[model samples]
Target chain A: MLTNEILQQRLTEKFGELVYNFEQPYGMLTFVTDRDNNLKVMNFLKESEDLGFTFLNDLTAVHYPDQLGKELAVVYMLQNIQAGLRIRFKVFTDITHPDVFTATGIFETANWLEREAYDFFGVNFVGHPNLIRIMNVEEMDYHPLRKEYPLEDQTRIDKDDDMFGR
Target chain B: MSQKQNIQLPEGSLGKQTTTLNLGPTHPATHGVFQNILEMDGERIIDAVPTIGFIHRAFEKIAEHRPYYQITPLTDRLNYCSSPINNMGWHMTVEKLIHAELPKRVEYLRVIIMELSRIADHLVCNSVIGVDTGAFTGFIYVFELRELIYEIFEEVCGSRLTTNIGRIGGFERNFSELAFQKINHFLSVFPKAMKEFETLFNRNRIFMERTMGVGGIAAERALNYGFTGPNLRATGIDYDIRTAHPYSGYQDFDFSVPVGTTGDVYDRYLVRNAEIWESISIITQAVKKIKELDPSVFHADIPDFYLPEKADVYTKMEALIYHFKIVMGETAIPAGEVYHSVEGGNGELGFYLISDGGRSPYRLHFRRPCFIYYQAYPEIIKGSMLSDAVVTMSSLNLIAGEIDA
Candidate 1:
């Protein structure tokens, strides 16, 4: 029942410029921010008295290769369980050197999720404790989710020669 | 391409030294082909490492080559237990990219079928948790109900496990009156069957002892792991994607999002049971609402996107041409990216689609609920007894198909 304007005002007062663009689409508030301010903004949101985004609903990445400047974006869907509000935070990163500050300190669940993001999209989470591959094996070089990976050309033939005869 | 490597334990000073055990890829406790190497000190698990990708099929890569319409069948294979929900979610994502509006009746039909699938999915979760705890009878009772639900699916889609029933814009076929009657019959029996399941396990002393306080996590920790759906709700969070963010006219249906005080295995079981009841309530309301509305309301208006009726294709040249175009997946959809998520039985099932103004999506990613929950397994079972690990993993209700996809 909380209005978007009131929520935005409270967030702005609490975290200043960290609260970037606030827009409501499909009846949920989306907050956009730069990679540099992600951890600070998340900490404030978690610890703030008025806004307690206590639950991280979902975390996933979106690739926009053709967009003029930003090539990759990671969207985090956060939920304040007490207030029943869901807000989405998006951090834009350059595909070449995609790195973002980790939120594992604030939310313990991000430990594996950040690893997954790192494995699939090759986005580095700078402060993660163990950022090694979670889904893919350690030696695999390419990030499968990146647009340049060319899904079609990755032969249907078995890549693991040990398991299947060539 | 290296030979299988053996894990070597360090030279030990005494029994207190660390002992390493590889628990899966064939172990009985592992429900699927999941392998976990654990460092243990006697009965306590010290550190656990999970290695997956055993059943990886590279689905996203294959989707890029297929046309928009052909991908529906591929989505069905992601979470094989709840195939219809995945199919509907994929269709909705494509619909969002194209900005196509589905008819009200079609939405209601989707609600009915999807809620039915939710009940089926939760039945497996509850029953499988019982099986993992050495209760075999519970599995049979719940699976019987699941079989009845699958019978309805087989009648409607002509396939049980992988039902590729949805087209791009709407459904491939409207629910026949017979299918509706069967669904009504299933609903009539579902509540009683649920009560029977609860009676069998809800208060059983052994079941409670195994699950009530095992593998618990706080709300804050659960949030950080990006847990969604019932597992997150079990952590006392009242966030349901359906109620928090309504999609497919879910706002019209009246239901409650169950929450628990402790995020334990028992809480997870109770929450899923409550959800089965809520799903039944939603399906009943949807069936009634759909029957009242006109049947034509179930069909979307985009002829180019929707497959032409068989009779129309035979009688009209334009219909034949459109049919050919749809079959070839040559229709040009506007370029855009859309994330469409629905509350799947396990958790939030999301489809993130990127279209490049082409026939096929340039990129497609699935935010699978199982993958997120399974990733948290090591942390949840840390320091607990080895037996509790099986209980915890089953309570998480992970589907290997979804996790690997």
Candidate 2:
């Protein structure tokens, strides 16, 4: 049984100020790291015998247009199957250069997941072997899931934005 | 008939013998709208590259704009074979965010519905594998059972295929007497049908020869690919989400997670078949447990989120106000991040929601399990005979809706 506290303590001790915003929202440990240290933190979590979160449960990105320089938050959900524990970590990068180190080398599941994140949020995954669009057409010019993009078609004149509470 | 003799071949014809075969975006064997570019040498596949996204509807993008309650219908479209599980999973994610305490009856009712849908899903998967392996009788046989399961869902929620069955806290209405009757009838009839279905293929020499050693994946490699549910269980890892992290009172029920050694096409089939039995056992336990609880209790008592009765709305001012608030999507949602996963038909289907104290989620991502399995398809099917690829795919149970979502 690896409790959140023990895992938090180990992460803080090793990474120190490099990791911050340690929160246990809904009893799942969450923290933030510098975009540069994303792979380092993930590698440490996987290789460390005490905190073996070997399973990459999910990988996706959340875009916050209001936050400058930290617009995109690439979230990774990791799980330790034996202990039945899960932890989430975020690495924030700017929209202009949304480059985060890829975890495809560590977990093979990250290959297509990283492609999905890149396809939706335009997050350039550094060092991913084949980071082409997986869910969208290659000819698509813009990422569709960003907050700025409207859900409805722009050219549709019959429906008003006010009706949708936009 | 006249050109019986062999003509002179080009010098490089023997060297470059492999042919490129485009399997589908519409092929009957593919079963879904996804294309596979296979490099084949005669009947054996040398390499495969799958191209997906034919049915991508951008649900994640749409989810960010819709009110939380309205998102249930969108979840229904994913894995349509077992949509009740997806619906319940979405509701549970929101419930986790709001911290709603469900009654025992609601939990047990949910368990029954979810397990029934699991049976429906696995029945489709296993029977389709049989169909691919040249046994069509089992497919026709179990489909009647699937219709029976759908009839039970119709009794509960008035819809069958794209059910959108339950609300955030619990079901829209209490389970009717007919629903329970149908469940009992199916329970009594399903085992015999399933046993017959199994008897047809489980010991047959042809079925065994086709699937026994085909499309095998090591346990370590399956884990590395983030495989879950029966596919991972087929690789001998008993990491079931129901046991690992119990949800919807799954801990109250007694069931077993069946595992296999080789993780091949046959192992996947066996795992799914065994899971159907386990789901039946779970539903049986839930029905028994529900008998001890109050029959009238269905949805939880969360006035803010749950819609009020139409009759009450017409008579009472409080009911009308709550009705208006919920219908207008004006209920307050707290700012937080929550990730909830349910063991879906295929694997661990997760909902990661980030709400900013708004009417809708600020960002919502569905951790679709089929998406993960599809990426591993090319590797799993490589070096296998063309006929074996079809069996491997059906056994994996890849749903294009879930994959491209």
Candidate 3:
């Protein structure tokens, strides 16, 4: 009963041009919105009787350094288990001031997920209680998963490909 | 000597107060490296704080640097109990991005491998729960069945624990006759052993008392915490990735999703036991279905990703060129984002990939189900006995590699 068209229409009718870039890459309905309306859009999707996407399947971040002003993209994969419907949405924020509203109040599982996002890409979830490093140690000063940071240490010349076949 | 002058009673030690106990980072009862700080009032736990990431390897960051085929081994470590499911899940994710259509025989072969590993994973988890609750016979009894399953993996892919069994499109080689014999042998032997395993613990008064009503959670709370796989099914939710979103021709196989009420440690055990039976049925069906298809169609016709035969590589120039490119990890993939999940050992193991028209992925994230559900541990074990906490942890099937990955 819940087809892609109905879900898209319901979203468009509710949020009106606010939610854009409707797409179905590999048959999953994915859309994009600004960081400001993420909580509003997610709450509407959860509270609305017709659109009951209560299960938060996944929450992760993608770092794109080339994209100016929107260098960080936070992705949320939500599913309505009863209806067997899943929808993905992204909220892009600037790298310098990467702040997005917390979804802990909406989904309890978002607690550690937000901490993980903040630990890796430094996406500061506003009003997130106890937002600290989850995977990496507390003393790590830099977000390692950001595009600005390289996977390997540049200072280690011994393992350089030119000198050693690595 | 009775009271030393230098000795001082700590602030809360003078009065009767809760004792703080650190359960593990390497405790044998934990089964893995998980540290849970427990605030206890005698034998009952008042609160618990679980600390993970002792085994975090930063697989996501590592995947960004490695090529597509190179990431399969990384997935193998996610849940070593059932590495094939993770391997096949990663392959399916890439296959989805590339739009590679696989043959029926290939999919059936994958189903057989995946279900066999599922049985292996469940055997370890269920038997470990038995050992945690003062029952050791079941642990030693079912492990041989797990070993037999591993032998099948060894025959197929030449490895044991971390069986990076399959390639991007399909298997590296067709299933050998010996492999089929092993499958049939396991299929014949597993059912009787599983029935014995169930008889040992299903209605045993001691196990029932120790696990039932201990660390039980409501179905609604379990869902809010992102429970999936057997854990979610144990909570009475019939949501299964294989049925909800069928992939790798799971729709062709018919099997019922088992559910349990009360979502306690006992219910989790029963659900896993029932699921083992269902997996047996599925593997039997797949073996029959594979016989109907052509045996030569193992790997798909994606020469860019799938490596050519060794004989062809040695003799033919075109095969040599394809082998060199595939081995050197120079296959440039299209720029796209795809999220694919398979019903893994513990839950829904997902791969979220983003490619920017490069040999390696732009970014790759593993939606580790253990990492999500483990967050609900402190809540699940709070206000329960210390021993109950250990039993609950085993029932949740928290794998350290998957959690910290």
How much is the lDDT of residue B157 in candidate 3? 96
- Summing lDDT over every window of 10 consecutive residues in candidate 3 chain B, give the lowest-scoring window: B1-10
TM-score pick, better of 1 and 2? 2
lDDT of 2 by residue, B348-372 (tens): 9999999998989999999989898
Taking the tens digit of each residue's C-alpha lDDT, what string does model 3 give over A47-147? 89988998999999999998999999999999988888889999999999999999999998899999999999999999998899999999999999997
TM-score of 3: 0.96
Docking class of 3: high
Please give the lDDT score for candidate 3. Answer: 0.92
Each candidate's fnat, in order?
0.50, 0.85, 0.81
Write model 3 residue lDDT over B1-405, tens digit each, in one string. 234467567877665367999999999999999999999988989988888889999999999998899999999999999999999999999999999999888999999999999999999999999999999999999999999999999999999999999899899988899999999999998899889999999999999999999878889999999999899999899999999999999999899999999999999999999999999999999999988889899999999999998999999999999999988877767888999999999999999999997889999999999999998998998888999999999999999999999
Q: Estimate each model's TM-score.
A: 0.88, 0.96, 0.96
Assess each model's interface with DockQ, reporting 2 decimals per model: 0.39, 0.85, 0.85
Give the per-residue lDDT of model 1 (tens digit) for A1-166.
5566777887788777867778776456778888898887777777877777876666667777887567888887776765667677789998888888887787766777778788888888898999987767789998887777765445766465645533
